[model samples]
Target: MNTNDSKLREQIAYFGRSMFERGLTAGSSGNISVRLDDGWLMTPTNCCLGNLDPADISRLTRSGVLVSGKAPSKEFFLHEAFLDRRPTDRAVVHLHSTYATAVSCLPDVDPRNVLPPLTPYSIMRFGKVALTPYHRPGDKRLGDEISIVAAEHRAVLLANHGPIVAAKDLESAVYAAEELEETAKLFLLLQGQRPRLLTPEQVAELERVFGEKEDDRAKTCC
Candidate 1:
């Protein structure tokens, strides 16, 4: 591998292990991908994130041909949808994290924005998390749904599935996904009580100060 690819491989493995150890995902139920100049690097299908080998990461050409390492995750198209819709996003993380998936399975959550504005960090990192209706795992139609929502959202909840998040780099993506999980956990914990939420004015201010430029980029990319 070239120097950059070698470095990215190790990075993926390192973060994958962190996610597993922290219980963000378990039992091979998640995938991570990084967009590269030539193509992309992704976690192998059905491999435990806790024990990934840097050399076993999957490499795909820009045209989506697998050129090295293990088979790519079946959810590659889901990751592609985000990258395609957000040119600035260089990495994607999809995880069946516990609290986030619990939120996805809940009925009556706002489909357009599943996550409530419970924290400023969530708003700053995610803007709003669209919720896509359920599709069987590996369904191509899931990608179609994700592309439509991802055009306006950097993070989304897959109904009865989990959360998928994209960002400018792997670290940002990982942090955003972690934030999503934590916000979900908070939402569940405070379900019965009327917890204070960020007001619309506050949300708008955050969007204006932090999200406006990215929204413009998203529009241009779409």
Candidate 2:
């Protein structure tokens, strides 16, 4: 194995543990993936994220065939949908995070854009968070729905499920997922009291400045 692949394995485990310990996800309820030159590295199925072993991370071929380690997560196709549609994206994070899943369960959110313009970072990281139609967990239909919106959105909330985020790298995908959950919490917190949002022009300016470079967004946004 190359040095980069080894590091990516450790990175996945590190973030998986962090997410699990912090309640971003629970049990074996979340998945993560990083695109490689030949294929991808993904968290194994039915494993607690908090207890991931770097060596046990699944390595799959470009065609999604398992090449090493354990079996990939059942939600493999969900990440596949984004990686297939967004050629430039190198990582994908899917989490059954509490607040985001709670928001997904809500009936009144906009189908086209589940998240309102509640925070500048949300608008900056996710231009518009699309809401995919509900499908049972690991259902290929869920991935299919994601494929339809992947062209226009880098992030999506699975109806009655949770959120999935894609980015140029694993760190960004993970951070975006965290940001999504925080934004969801803020959304729910302000449900009764109408909160003012960024104007269209302000959102446009953010899109123009921080949108073009996903990798540089964090460095430049501050």
Alpha-carbon TM-score of each model against the true structure? 0.94, 0.97
Cα deviation of 14, candidate 1, in Å: 0.7
**All candidates: CA RMSD (Å):** 4.3, 1.0
Per-residue alpha-carbon lDDT of candidate 2 for residues 1-222, written as tens digits (9 for 90 to 100): 789999999999999999999999998899999989899899999999999999999999988999999999988898988889999899999999999999999997787888889888998777799899898997899989999999889989999999999999998898899999999999999988979998999999888888776668878656
What is the C-alpha lDDT profile of model 1 across 139-165, one tens digit per residue? 999999998888789999999999999
Off by over 4 Å in 2: none
Which stretches of candidate 1 lie above 4 Å from their native place?
212-222
Number of the predicted model whose TM-score against the real structure is largest: 2
